[model samples]
Target chain A: MTNAIEVTGLRKAYGSVQAVKGIDFYVERGKLFAFLGPNGAGKSTTIDILCTFLRPDAGTVRIGAYRLGEEDRQIRGMIGAVFQDGLLDPLLTVEENLRLRGGFYDLRGRALTQAVEDIMKQVGVSDLRRRPYGKLSGGQRRRCDIARALVHAPEILFLDEPTTGLDPQTRKSVWQTLHGIQREKGMTVFLTTHYMEEAAAADYVLVMDHGEIAAKGTPSQLKDAYARDKLILVCHDTARTAARLREKGLACTETADTLELPLASTLDALPIIQDLREEIRDFEVIRGTMDDAFLAIAGEAIRE
Target chain B: MMGFALRNLKVFFRDKAAVFFSLLSTFIIIGLYALFLGDVWTSNYEGVPGIRYLMDSWIIAGLLTATSVTATMGAFGIMVEDRGKKVVKDFVVSPLQRRSMVGGYVLSAVTVGVVMSVVTVVLGEVYIVINGGDWLGASELCQVLGLILLSTLTNSAMVFFVVTFFSSTNAFATASTIIGTVIGFLTGIYLPIGSLPETVQWVVKLFPPSHAAALFRQVMMAEPMAEAFATAPAQTADAFREMMGVQLVFGSTEMPAWGSLLVLLATALLFYGLSVVVLSRKAR
Candidate 1:
């Protein structure tokens, strides 16, 4: 019924470079909103301004019921953030780190202890509570980082590229954990990421490029408007297959091992597959994805 | 603010290496004095009654003053390390007030300065008594302890101001090394101010910790000083006290104990006000 975050004409600059330029967006409460952009885009800058880490040159921002600059303390109390860098003290144990972070929010004594235990358990890191933060694996440390931010039971969570350096399996598990927490707590999540599939899971997506919002919409809507599903054929000889398709006036792009023919509809796959017969080693009519939606809208692939 | 301050203290104490390195300069000064400088100074004052007591007290007082400066420098290193690793940003984004954050760091520095300086005083007293010197009386010991608090406040405030220019731990370490080497000369411990050129003596007199050192020696070495100069003419005893840096002389006017104490108090207040202004501006 209300917006979790609202911004209008938010602008920020560093010397000669404009990091965020007159951006406007609002995320609904209890929804997972993904902010997607390539390298050097304004995604991180926007998040920093919203989280009160950096002061914007000009803007009107409201987080829940609190104003950005004027009521920053209240806004900070309502939000939790996992920074792009490791914020945990390496020498401190996981439990010690959690308690210290809890102390920052003025949570202490039995109440602090209980909150720390509950958050650690909720993030599946209760068993690692006594372990030193430096000794934990990357995935484990991330779990602890998330648990630290959640100790205060913030109403909104800001995750800045939370899974950037994690391995694929670890990334997937973190995603699942994030989804689980969001679903269970019904807290608003504002995420910035370069992974399209991660953004694909969001109820709403905002794509930024070169300090401006290039596009914003739901995944399905963007896919319908700008992206098309492709019928991909992985063959022993994709060059010959591509030549054959081109002779028939069917436009297809060929890579080393596959030929990608954009399909207007799923029904078109039936005729193409039947005509190819034994020439096709393997084929699948893949559905449209946020990757395509992003490429079509942002005009560049997401840089790692 | 208390929680943040306590967290800093815990982090400093838990890191054995940091704790050791923070007091490393103090130990080095004492070690060098015991091995080489101690004999040289004692030989110069040979046959002066209670010379061992007076000279030992002088070096120990200087060491105590140095301890607060060096230990506070070490304590501020945590702030630099946290900034380098971006851990400070975590605090910035939290609900903690900016004043509280600055206050936490300032309080931690003061705590470290006082705690480590007290330990140094204990060690110095042990060494003095082993070398056949007497401990201070109740009133004298209270005066020494009171000076420790004021000296630590001044040192903490001064160091906090210096650290604001640094964000990287490596740069801060370099600054710490520079301070460690230069502070001895400024405080007139490495070389007595009377033996130096007049301009150099002026510099030492103007240095804040030099005043602290003067205050510490005045109270700590009073009994020994009285005994050593008991038979000498009043002017000669006054001259010896000035030469040894137990009393500060600017031109012909001798600075009284109250003057040095006032200088220390003013130094503490001025630097603390400047540090707060700088921290608040940076917060903005």
Candidate 2:
């Protein structure tokens, strides 16, 4: 399948200050692509350029098949976006809001009704269709926003900080709903979020820093490159165990009751554990988390 | 565009406070006239013929013209609120054209202006009859309705232009309140045109809504005006007409009805053009 979005050398500047300085990325069709960054990391600027809300200083951005600048109106019809703030009318019922959004895509008569009904059911908000949007809880409002965005059934969905202010349970459910929609519709979901775990779930993650891509890979690839796997042992002798491991050519950190082995991968911890099995009381291997990878990578970018 | 317009219409009518506040000035005008202005004017013009009918017709005309101004400004609260809540971004990202969005706002504001002003006309006519004045003839009523459409267009265009400068709801609320207060003075509703200083009277006369008021008076007050002046001297009727803003008099000549219509038509076109220019510039 072709790329759902293609942004090449996208450079956008506000007067003298460059917000997105010559960045490039693409999202494959039917894949979840995530951009992870801090507040001023140019994630939003780049997304705005692709969404045709902000014109880039120089770049060729194609949304699905439509060009960003030349075919902006067409691109708009082919994509849906949910920004951080609530944009749906508070006084309007869930169904009314969906009907209004579907109207923008020229859905009317029976087609409009069908689209509204389909979107509500697809986003699992069918039960709340008649409820006023303002009366909904935070999670429910977020679901309505997603439902409104999908009313037109666009091939690509752009979400800016999809779960920024929700509680953990609500965020988890929101992500679950998103995954369901993406799976059922084979939709390309491109989102920018501050949550590392959210980005880890994406098929591809692009870490941005200071208007540039600091790292881009699968979660495990990033963890392998920027973070380490741990091999820990519960033992009685702290001093002798450390010497025995060092003499046998295993590098480890010694503590009062345990020795730690930092290795390239969890697979690398096997041989060390096999060699130290007799002296060790118990051992366990810990895989690095996305947060660990982020600290090791984005932490350096922030410090510099 | 029609969907957006319908949504705006729905939202405006749903907010009961907004609808009432839009007509708050109209109620104030009626209250002032009822409390003391009505008796004071009737007593002051005791010797004149048909004085009650003339003053009633004058206040009714001023109320009709001012409704378009206040109601449309209140209607524009939706536009400013949309901007403040960032709801406009959703429309910007949709397939809806920029012109369509703008047209939706203009259409809805004009609709609200026309709807509210017509209601004012009906209520004003009923008030006149209850005060012992004859109901306007069908032809005159039709003419008044046509005038309502035109004046609403002009008033809404001007209000929409002013609203483009505001985005916050607080700022919009303050602006609508200021506009509501200033509308009476602008249309010579709170006081007659001749009551102001000479230069200030010119400013009121130049005001587009005042011309609308004059046009309304030309139609609604035509019979009563003739009755009031039939027993008086020739210049007396002209003085009363000029004082009460029934006719916009220039330095030496009275402005004909067509002249007021021309002012209103020109004002509508000019404001519409100005609003489009400002909006297009902002888009760029």
Task: List the candidate 2 regions with Cα displacement exceeding 4 Å.
Answer: A231-261, A267-284, A300-304
DockQ per model, Cα: 0.77, 0.71
TM-scores for all predictions: 0.95, 0.93
CAPRI tier for the interface of model 1: medium
**Runs off by more than 4 Å, candidate 1:** A234-244, A254-258, A278-281, A301-304
Candidate 2: tens digits of C-alpha lDDT, residues B1-284: 99999989988998889999999889899999999998888897898877888899989999998889999988889999999987898998899999989899889999999999889888888988888898899999999999999999999988888998898999889888888888899889899898899998989988999999999999999988888888788788888888889878899888999988999999899999998899888884
Clashes of 1: 0
lDDT (10s digit) by residue, model 1, range B174-224: 889889878988998887878888889889999999999999989998899
Task: State the displacement of the C-alpha of residue A163, model 2, in Å, after optimal TM-score superposition.
Answer: 1.9
TM-score quality measure for candidate 2 = 0.93
Docking quality level of the chain pair in candidate 2? medium
Per-residue alpha-carbon lDDT of candidate 2 for residues A1-304, written as tens digits (9 for 90 to 100): 7899888988988888888888788889999998887778888888777777878899788888888889999999989999998799888889888998899999999999998888888778999988989899989999999998889999999999989899999999999989999999999999898788898898998888888888999887887788888989887687888988889888989776888888777898887767767777898899888888877777745532
Model 1 alpha-carbon miss at residue B36, Å: 0.9
RMSD values, in order shown: 2.0, 2.7
